[model samples]
Target chain A: MTTTEKIRGLILKVAKGKLSQEALKPEARLSEELGLDSLAQSELLVLAEDSFGIKFTHDEVWTVATIGQMVEVIDSRLAAK
Target chain B: MRQSAGILGTGACLPEQVLTNLELAERFGVTPDWIFERTGIVQRHIAAPEQACSDLAIAAARQAMENAATAPEEIGMVIVATITGDYTTPATAAIVQGVLGIPAVACFDLSAACSGFVYGMIVGSHAISCGFCNKVLVVGSEVLSRFTNQTDRDSAILFGDGAGAVVLGGVPEGYGLLATDAGTCGTEYQAIIIPAGGSRLPPSAETIAAHLHYSHMDGNQVFMFAMRVLGNSTLRTIEKAGLSLDDISLIIPHQANRRIIEAAAGRMELPLSKIVINLEQIGNTSSASIPIALHGVLTDGRIRHGDRLVLTGFGGGVSWGSALIRWHSPGSDQIHKKEKNDDNN
Candidate 1:
C-alpha cells in the first residue's frame, strides 16, 4: 500500500472507527477535523511509527499537524531506511 | 535464592472530602460525561484544608505498622515517597518517623513522582538484603490538591490527595520480591513538572500570581511515555524475575489515566481483570497510586498468599519502575496450613 494509505489506516486504528475513510483528507487536522485529541494524536504517531517501520524524532512528532504532514514525516523516515 | 524483602502489610488513607465529576464539570462549564469520558473518574478524594501530606502519610504508616503487627521500635527505616511534602526543607519521612516513634535508624524522602513507591520498594528491599535495616516502612503520600491549579480543568480533574504505606521485611526466599527494574528518561522531565517553587524558579509574588507552583503536565507527552513504558517495563521485570506473564496473577499499575492503562494492557495482551485499577474513585494520587491500589485490592481479598503480582508505574522524572512480588501476607503460613488441612478433609 502507498504511504498515504498506510498512514490513513493507522489513523483509523487510532480513531477506532470514529472517523470514516472519506473524512481522512490529506489536509484533515488530526486534532480538529479528525477529532483525535492530544493523547490520540500521540497514539497515532506511535502507531504510524510501528506500522511504517519508521521513527519520528521528538521534533518531527510535534511538527505534524495534519494527516498530510504525518504522511510526509513517515515517507521521509521510510526513505532514510 | 536467599530470603527477600516483601510487603508484610499495606494500608491507605484518603481524605473524607469527595470531588465528584459533576461538581468539577459544573465548575468548568462542561458536562459530567465530558469529564468522565476523558478521565474515567467518577470521583476523587480531596484533603481538607487542614490536612497536609505528612498527616496523610502518618495515618497510613500507623495502619501499615499495626497491620504488620510490628512495633514502632522494630522499624529501622522510614521512607516517604512524595512530591508534595508539607515543608520544603525537612523530609516528610522524618516527620512520619517521629510521629510513629519508629526510633529512626534512617529517614529520608524519595521523589520519582508517580514511580516513587516502586522505587522506594526497590531501595527499601535492597536495604534489607544488604543488612542495612531490619524492617523498612515505605510510604507514598501526596497532596496534589495543594499543587494543583483548581481553575485549570485539565489538571484539576486528574489529581487527588491520599497516602498509602507498606511495611517491608524478609520473607521466604522464593516468596517475596523476585526482581525489579527502574530507569529514567531525563530528557522528558519537562513533560511532568511544577515549573516553580524549586531553586530553578523560587517562589516569588510573580511566580505565585502566574500559578507556577501548580503542577503542569503535557498530557500528550505523559500519555505517550506511559503507554510506551508501562506494560513493557512490567514484562521486563517479570523476565528478570525468571518468570513469565502466565505466573503473574495481577498487574498493579500507576493510576494515571484509564485510557493509558487500557492501551498499555492492550499492548501486553493482558486482560483488564488481571490489572488493578482504582482510579475511578482515586483519580491520580501520584506516588501514592500504586500502594493505594495495592491496599485496596488486599483489603478486598483480591490478593492471596502465593499470588504473584507485578507492580509497575511511570511518572515525573520521566521515570518508570516495576517490581515483581510474590504475595506473602502476614500469617500466610497459617492460612496455607489451614487450606491444606481442609483439602485433606
Candidate 2:
C-alpha cells in the first residue's frame, strides 16, 4: 500500500469504529475533521510504528500533524532504510 | 464552651479481589520487593466488574451505622467523599443514602480527592454543632481500580478499591470534634487528576482510545506535596484545637505511601507507634484511607476513652485537612450489630 493509504488504514484501525476512510483524507485536519485528541494522536504514532516498522520519537510525532505529513515522513524514512 | 462531636462508630470495606505486589510486579516487569520498598504497598483490593463507587460506600455506611447503634432514619445527613463517583451529576452520597434506606437525610458528595473524608467530618461536625443535623454519616469510597491504567506501573500499584465510613453525633461539652482545618490549592490540580472526561475535554472515541478517562499523577511532585502538607496540616489543626502535638493520643493521616507517612511523623516528632499505618494491605484508598485506618485502630483496641486523636489528609485538588477529636465510649467491646434494633427500645 502507498504511505498515505497505510497511514489512513492505521488511523481507522486504532480508532476502531470511529474513523473511516471517507473521513480521514490526507489533507483533512485530523483533530478537527477526524476528532483525534492528544491520546488518540499518540495511539496513531504507536500504530504507525507497528505498521511501517519504524520508530518515531515524541518530537517527530509533534512535527507530523496530518495524515499527509505523516505519510511523507514515513515514506522518506522507509526510502532511507 | 464548644460542643463536641465524637466518632460514634467506624467501619471499612474492601472489594473481594486482592491484588498482591507479586501479581502486579509480574505484569510490570518489576521486582515485588521493589514495589514494596518504594511504595510500601503489598496488596490492594479490586472491585468486581459490576461494582461502582456507591456500592462500596453503602457497605461502609451500613457498617458505621450498625457500629454506632444508630438507625438509618436517625442519620440526619450523609456525606460521601470521592473522586470516582458512579455518575458525574447525582451525588454518590444520595445514592448511598437511597440504598441504605435513609431517605430522610440530606446527602451530597465532596471532591477533595483523598482528603475528602476529613473534609466531610469537618462539614458534618459543623452542621451538627450549628443544629443543622444531629447524626451525620461521613463516607469515603473509591473504585480507583476501574479508572486505573493497567499498563501504568507508576499509578497501578498505588491505588485500590475500598470504602471507609464514620458516624458522627453531637456529644456533651468538650467531648466530640474539637477543631478542624481544611484548605486547597488549585494550582497543584495537575499534580494528580483524570485529564479527560470533564467539560474541558469531554469523552469521545479519541478519549477512549487514549484512555483519558484513566487516572494520572506526577508521583514525585505529589510525594513532596504529601510529605509537606500531612505534617503541616496536622500541626496546624492541633494548634487550632488549643493543644500541642504531644496531646494527640493517635494520629491518623492519609495512607498514600509509607515513606510519606513516616516522614510526616518524623517531622511532627511523633513516634511510629502513635501513627496508624495500613498501606501494606490497602494501598491508597484516597478519601477512604483515614476512616479505614481509624476503623482498624478501633478494632485493634488501640484507642481508649477520652484519648485525644488527630486526623489529617492531603490529596488531589491539592486538598488537605486535619481534625482533632476526643474518643468517646472508646475501648467498649460493643459488638456492632448490623441488625436495626430500635435504640429507643
Candidate 3:
C-alpha cells in the first residue's frame, strides 16, 4: 500500500481501533481533533517505530502535530532507509 | 516439591486526603481531561505531612494480622517492599516490626521499585518453604507523595501514597503459591530513577537545587518495558505452575498506568475484566499496586477457592516479576467472625 494508506492504518491503531474515517485525512489535527494526550502521543511514537521499522527520538515522536506531519516524518525515515 | 505459602488475608490502607484529577490539573496547568486520559487516574490518596511509609505499613499490617486471626507474637518474619521509605538507612521493616510489636523476628526491606511487592512475596514464601519461618507478614507501602516532584507533570500526575499487606501461612495441599518468575533489566536502570542522593552522586546543595532527589522517568521507555515484560512474566509463571492461560482466574498487575495494563491484557489475550486494576482509585502506588489490586479483587469476591491468580509488576531497577497462586484462604472462616466482632465492639 501507499505511505498514506499505511499512515492511516497506524492512526486507527493509535486511536485504539476507533476513529472516524475523515479523521485520517492528512490535515486532521491529531491533538485537537483526534485527542492524543502526551501519554498516547508517546505510545503512538513507539508504535510508529515498530510499524514502519524506523526509529524516532522521544521528542520527535511527541512533537508531531497533524496527520500530515506524522506521515511526512515517516516518509522521510522510509526514504532514508 | 516445597511448602507452599498461602495468602491468609489482605489489607489496604489509603490515606484520608484525596487528590482529585481536577485538582491536579489545576496545579499542573493542564486540563482535567488530559490527566484522566493520560493516566486513567480519577483520584489518589495523599499522606499527611507526618505520615511515613511505616505508618501506613502499621495500619495495613494490623488489619492483615487481624484478618488472619494472628496475634503480633505469632508472626515470624516481616518483609517490607518499598521505594519511598522514611529513610534510606534503617530498613522500613524494622520500624514496622517495632510498631507492630512483632518481637525481634527477621525484618528487612526489599526495593525493586514497582516490582518490589511481588518480589517480596517470592522471598517471603521461600523463607516459609525453607522451614525458616512459619508465618510472614509481607507489606508494600510507599509515601511517594513526598518524593514526587510537584512541578513535573509527567511524574507528579502518576503517583500516590498507600500501603497493602498480606499474611503468609500454611494452606491446604494444592492450594497455595504455585510459582514465581522475577527479572531485572538493569541496563535500562536509567529509564526510571532519582538521579542523586545516592553513593553515586551523594547529596549536595547543587543537587538539592536541581531537585535531583525527585523521580525522573522516561515515560516512553517505562511504558515499553512494562508492556513487554508484564504479560510475558505472567505467562512464564503460569507455565511454571503447570497451568495454562485458560486456568488463570485473574491477573493483578502493577498499577502504574491503565494503558500499559490494557496492552498487557490484550497481549495475553485476556479480557480487561480478567485483570484486577485499582489504579483509577489510587494512582501508581509503586510496590503497593499488586497487593492493593489483590485486596480490591478479594474484597469484591472476585477471587474464590481453587482459582488461579497471577500477581505481576514491572518498574524501576528495570525489574519485573510474577507470582502465581491457587486461591484458598487459610483463615477465611475467621473473616466474618472478625467483621462481626468489629461491629459489636
Q: Which candidate number maximizes DockQ? A: 1
How many angstroms is residue B19 displaced in model 3 relative to the true structure, after the best TM-score fit? 1.3
Provide the clashing-pair count of each candidate structure.
0, 3, 0
Give candidate 1 regions above 4 Å deviation. Answer: B332-345
* Structural RMSD, model 3: 3.5
Give TM per candidate.
Answer: 0.94, 0.77, 0.88
Whole-model Cα lDDT of every candidate shown, in order: 0.88, 0.83, 0.85
Q: Candidate 3 on B1-345: residue-level lDDT in tens? A: 577788998889999998888888899888988888778899889999999999999999998898788999989999999989988879999999998889889999999999999888988888888889889999999999888898888878899999999999877778778889999989879999988889998999999899998999988778877776888898899999888988898989899999888765654566787788788889999998788888777776677778899899899989998999998855754445545676898
Question: What's candidate 2's DockQ score?
Answer: 0.01
* Highest TM-score model number: 1
Q: Which stretches of candidate 3 lie over 4 Å from their true place?
A: A1-7, A17-35, A45-81, B332-345
Q: What does candidate 2's lDDT look like per residue over B1-345, in tens digits?
A: 445677888888999999999999999998999888768899999999999999999999888888888888889999999999999979998899888989667899999998899989999998888888888999999999888998899889899999999999877787888888889989878989898999999999999899999998866557656766887788888888889867888999999988678655654567888788999999999999999999988876677778899899998988899989887872223422211132434
Residue-pair clash count for candidate 3: 0
Query: Candidate 1's C-alpha lDDT?
Result: 0.88
- Candidate 1: what is its chain A TM-score? 0.92
Interface RMSD of each: 1.4, 15.0, 2.7
Best first by lDDT, ranked: 1, 3, 2
CA deviation > 4 Å runs, candidate 2 = A1-81, B330-345
TM-score of 2: 0.77
